[model samples]
Target: MTTLDSGERRRGSDTRPLITELIDEGTVESIAQEAWISLVGEDEVLVPLPGGPATDPVSSWVDVVGPWTGSVVLTTGRRTAEELTRALLREHSPAVLEEEDVADAFGEIANVVGGNVKAALPGPSGLSLPDVGSAPALRNPADLCRVELQWRGEPVSISVQGALPPLPAPR
Candidate 1:
């Protein structure tokens, strides 16, 4: 078999764009706004302001794999998550919400946002089912796009971060 020159770059090596390059805070906010309108309530709006840090934070995310592999994560306080669950359920919500209820609703929000984010990226991508719990570690700082907002006066943050670590600098 014939081999290429030493300096030649391999196909599919270091070609994927970082998450920040592919998406921005505005696009992410619009996506989240649409999701909120559809899933939360017709009048619900996400105020585009940093609401500071969340207390007793909970997160939901979905993994995306394709030309770029990463996760789309949504985080908020536990009480806020419960409120979001109620809003999603609307009149169907029970007086006493269960942990599973919050998980299901919050995870669904992440799924919707992640699906849209995946569509925005260069495709032939695979999306994982949503997972709810702690946020995934930020593996590569350069590969992240994050937005902070307030929904019903509660803090919520959405972060799209690469799963892969940063590539080594060339010698």
Candidate 2:
């Protein structure tokens, strides 16, 4: 799949299963519990991941697996990740994850979590990578359909925007 946003064309080529399937496996295996599911999109969310307010200002990770690719980035915020973490793990022991973990969570969310949903697309031509990151003014995937879920009250956004056109598998 190839995507065009902000004048940049991202080319992707993979032929594997869907991202949602991967997410199901991870969610079941991983300790993170399954939360609510929403069908629809939303406007740009200025909310950044909660974590460190220092040196590790931000970090992003991206990877391509099977029919899709993903990226994730750790972030920080005014509310503080600790508070957000508490809310997310509210059902659990509460202190389960720290703010720093939020970015990693975001990255993983973009990867397996976001991947699972994006993979649901009909064609094999999907995304290039799950980019986990922060800073540089995160681009909004407004064009694609997205879903929002909350973990301990914190919002985890999942987007399934498609590539430009010629929605065919890459060679």
- Top of the candidates by lDDT: 1
lDDT per residue for candidate 1 within 14-55, as digits (tens), equals 566898778899999999999999999889999999999999
Reference-based lDDT, each prediction = 0.94, 0.37
Q: How close is candidate 1 to the true structure, as a TM-score?
A: 0.93
lDDT of 1 at 39: 94
TM-score of each: 0.93, 0.34
Residue-level lDDT for 66 in candidate 2: 37
TM-score of candidate 2 to 2 decimals = 0.34
